[model samples]
Target: MKCADGGGGGGGGDTEAEDGGGVNVTLTTTTLPS
Candidate 1:
């Protein structure tokens, strides 16, 4: 159904956003220590 697909898409978007934020934080920390 359309509703189910929409929900799944939203969840995937949230996960991607969180992953991107985590990666940015890790890069910043690594750079700061060098």
Candidate 2:
């Protein structure tokens, strides 16, 4: 899942990994100049 571009404010990415009935979530953020 990804959030819409925050108009140069910032952006983030979320990933979910499933492993043997376990769920792992990873989050990443990106920065951009307007």
**Highest lDDT against the true fold, candidate:** 1
TM-score of every candidate relative to the true structure: 0.39, 0.13
Which RMSD does model 1 reach against the true structure?
Answer: 13.9
Q: Per-residue CA lDDT of candidate 2, range 1-34, in tens?
A: 1323332222121222233112111112222222
- Window of ten residues with lowest summed lDDT in model 1: 1-10
Q: Residues 1-34, candidate 1: write the lDDT tens digits.
A: 4444444444555566865655554455445544
Look at candidate 1 and tell me the lDDT of residue 18. 60
Candidate 2 deviant stretches above 4 angstroms = 1-15, 20-34
Angstrom error at residue 1, model 1: 0.4
TM-score of candidate 2 to 2 decimals:
0.13
Q: Tell me the lDDT of model 2 at 6.
A: 35
Please give the lDDT score at residue 29 for candidate 2.
20
